[model samples]
Target: MTLKPLADRVVVKMVESEETTKSGIVLPGSAKEKPQMAEVIAVGPGTVVDGKEVKMEVKVGDKVIISKYAGTEVKFDGQEYTILKQSDILAIVE
Candidate 1:
């Protein structure tokens, strides 16, 4: 199964968090923070939302930074994904 976003929403998969710090110190799983970076899995067509035209600026396979607490989490086939509005995306990583 696949996730298809509607309106100006987007579906993203979280990038794995690093287990080691810059100093090469291995941190425990309990010390890891939620990853803010993600890879775009699916994109929604640009649509008018809240009386304003929302255009999709990102596409599938693009890496992006999103608000830390944004999006709804869903689990499918034992994999987790986030579904959120395009506006929730902060920037597209080049």
Candidate 2:
């Protein structure tokens, strides 16, 4: 199943954090924190500002690093997706 964001919303697939510690010690499954970095899966066309449509800054396939505590988490059809405003994006990864 495919999902699309609406308005100024964006969808990101979170990238998994480190599986092992710096000492090369493998961490347990339950020890991982949700990564803040993710790849942009889809994006809304644009947002309306002052009755004018503004183009989105990021595009599909752009890797982004977001804030640790940002956006709303949503699940659809057993798949997880993050719904964040375009302004919530911290930076675009090269």
Candidate 3:
């Protein structure tokens, strides 16, 4: 099965967070913070809302930073994904 987002929405998979700090200390899972970065898996076509056209800036395979608490989490076929509006995406990582 595949995930296809609707207008103005995007689907992404979270990038794994680092398990060790700069000092080479291995942190436990309980001490790790959720990663803000993700890789774009799918993008929705532009949408029209309130008489304005909202174009999607991100595309598949683009790495980006998402809002701290944005998007809904989904589990499919043993993999996890997040579906959110384009607006919820903060910046693209080059």
TM-score of each: 0.84, 0.76, 0.86
State how far residue 80 of model 2 sits from its true place (Å).
0.9
List candidate 3 segments past 4 Å from native: 19-30
The order of the candidates by lDDT, greatest first, is: 3, 1, 2
- Ranked by TM-score from best down, the candidates are 3, 1, 2
**lDDT, residue 30, candidate 1:** 55
lDDT of each: 0.91, 0.84, 0.92
Residue 69's lDDT in candidate 2: 69
| Ten residues in sequence with the least summed lDDT for candidate 1 | 26-35
Winning candidate number (lDDT)? 3
Candidate 2 on 15-60: residue-level lDDT in tens?
Answer: 7765767889997645777687888989987889899887799998
Which has the higher lDDT value, candidate number 1 or candidate number 2?
Answer: 1
- Model 1 earns a TM-score of 0.84
Roughly what TM-score does model 2 have, to 2 decimal places? 0.76
Where does candidate 2 clash, by residue pair?
A: none
Better-scoring candidate (lDDT), 1 or 3: 3
* Model 1 spans > 4 angstroms off: 19-30
Off by over 4 Å in 2: 19-32, 50-53
Query: By the TM-score metric, which is better: model 1 or model 3?
Result: 3
